[model samples]
Target: MTPRLSNQMEKFYKFPDPPELAVQLRTYSVQRWPTMNHEWRKNKLASILRMKARRLASYWYAEESLSPRVDELEAILALLKLPEEVIERENLNELQALKERVARLEALLAQAGALDLGEQVDGGS
Candidate 1:
């Protein structure tokens, strides 16, 4: 399989399987399944799953639409995964060094009378 597909499979495996998820959902719901009719139970389950999918889609995609098809929801969740890449660690040391260098250069320019202190330095010392 392609690397991207492999990575997606790896991510998908990290989450619980559909059956386990369904069981968990069942436990989470307050519905009394034994008293409810079969057809109504099935509809309720489908409704719960779709509601969950819409919530997840809103969180992950930042946009919500009318209900997506089951296959579309599954594809979106299984393939796309969470946005773990949104945040990246910046090189703080490098940034600090650059800031210090700029400060020093600014100081030198001020000393040489090349830089005016008349509201030009907005970042007041």
Candidate 2:
């Protein structure tokens, strides 16, 4: 067998095949599961959005500060069409606003569930 196929076979061999009835029962259970409630859905969506926004802001800041001067200048000139300092200030302000929005969402989520912001549902610290 080719190395790739051999590797895949090895991975597949790690788990025993389930009985057909077991598989059917698992599938049925999943299909019968109820949709999440509004508060749970909102909290999940807010968590995802906040994480994405923070990651994007971190990437933008890292690229702005860590790239070579020539590359940075070219990027600023080609993309921003404004002074670097102005762009940096604008980006910082936007990041700050995003953080504040996330904080507000967290507070709302906590209040909706009647849970403290620092508390976890599973009782983990």
Candidate 3:
């Protein structure tokens, strides 16, 4: 059986490695070079983590510092809107009055139409 195995089959049976095993092996092997030592990689990771922590802390600080000011400005804006709210109420009242006037005019027109219809029926007779 060993004698019957081709070179490619022999290597496959000898190593029995997955396809991606070579890629992972080569990546780690390159990192083991003298210039890419373990301590440097550890420090680099530490610095990156520190920078991220500092950024998040600064964001939290800004939000906390500005929260009360934001609330104050919102309160001032509500105060500024008082006059507009009053104007809106007045406009709504005027619209209701116009609607009532239109209803009265429609009722009068309906009565006049009925009178004309009656007159026409009597005249035809």
Candidate 4:
């Protein structure tokens, strides 16, 4: 019998994957690395994580106490909860502003394309 699996994944898997949504991020990662360097970067990150684990273990077992800055940051994170309504309101406001700016810029770009290139001004299309 042929085993069936989800088509969400390819027959041959790829590593160090960024989703299709991160279109520009994929390009930036490829540009940063040489050919086959993506695999190397993934391995390097794993090694660094292990090293950090060791450091954290050592720190935890040490007799030394927490630094004031670290303690303060922990407290701040714990205490920083916001109301859901406030967060939703803030997000909606930001999104509306972004949409407005995009609409205005798109309008200007369309106007500029309709005119001579050299005659376009910053404030007016």
Candidate 5:
């Protein structure tokens, strides 16, 4: 008897490397600033997070004390009561920006007949 492959097994999964993941998290946090509830809290946390991101990025690149930075990040996440995974998900504003960019790129590529309609329709199956 042949075993059936799960949907997860059928697709390629590529996670971002540590530095890239840090950048993504930082970008997500900064993008979240405008929609944050309280004005002062929003400004304060955002600034602190950016600073932390800079420090963390430097330490990450230098291979220095990483645990402290990670602990700081966790504390920030806990104070915010936000899960890291939720923060990693694309927000609405970012989604709209990405959609616009994709549309523009698609238009340009379509002109050059570089868009693959078949693969898109088939969902790469």
Candidate 6:
């Protein structure tokens, strides 16, 4: 073997497989259950899983899309309630933070069927 070729060969060494590894590989290949049923059950299961994933994703997105103004009422809560990534990305200022807090409160109020903002009150004097 030439010195240059021997020096290059040193970088890549072919690993010798153990006897047990070879036996395991052979058995695994033969026992592998790769065949799957191409029927409606699998299709239904896949569709259900897909819908579940979409629902979960929508929930996450809903939680994330908040008004920054309502977020800063309680100094501690605003920080605690913020998602990890958002907190890491940037610090919320006073105005935006306040918006977030207000938004959250509004959401709760709306859920409780109170704090009617859309109604115009009139004094019939």
* lDDT on C-alpha atoms for all candidate structures: 0.48, 0.44, 0.44, 0.42, 0.52, 0.39
Tens digit of per-residue lDDT, candidate 3, span 1-125: 56666653554443313333323323332343235654453344235334343332332233333222233333323432346557468557867998999999888768868777756655777
State the TM-score for model 5.
0.29
lDDT of 6 by residue, 62-94 (tens): 334422221121322332345655644443453
Model 2, C-alpha of 16: deviation from truth (Å) = 64
Q: Write the per-residue lDDT of candidate 4 for residues 1-125, one digit (tens) a residue.
A: 33454443343243222233123223333443335465453343225334343333332233244222343223322322345566468657967998999999998778777885535465454
- Candidate 5: how many backbone clashes? 0
- For model 5 the local lDDT of residue 67 reads 39
Estimate candidate 1's RMSD in Å. 17.9
Candidate 4 Cα outliers beyond 4 Å, as residue runs: 1-66, 70-75, 118-125
TM-scores for all candidates: the values are 0.30, 0.29, 0.28, 0.34, 0.29, 0.18
Task: Give the residue spans of candidate 3 off by over 4 A.
Answer: 1-82, 117-125
Candidate 2 overall lDDT versus native: 0.44
**Candidate 2 ranges with C-alpha deviation above 4 Å:** 1-80, 115-125
Q: Please report the candidate that would top TM-score against the real structure.
A: 4
Which candidate leads the pack in lDDT? 5
- Each model's backbone clash number: 0, 0, 0, 0, 0, 15
For model 4, state the Cα shift of residue 97 in Å: 1.5
Comparing 3 with 5 on TM-score, the higher-scoring candidate is 5
For model 3 the local lDDT of residue 36 reads 61
Clashing residue pairs for model 2: none
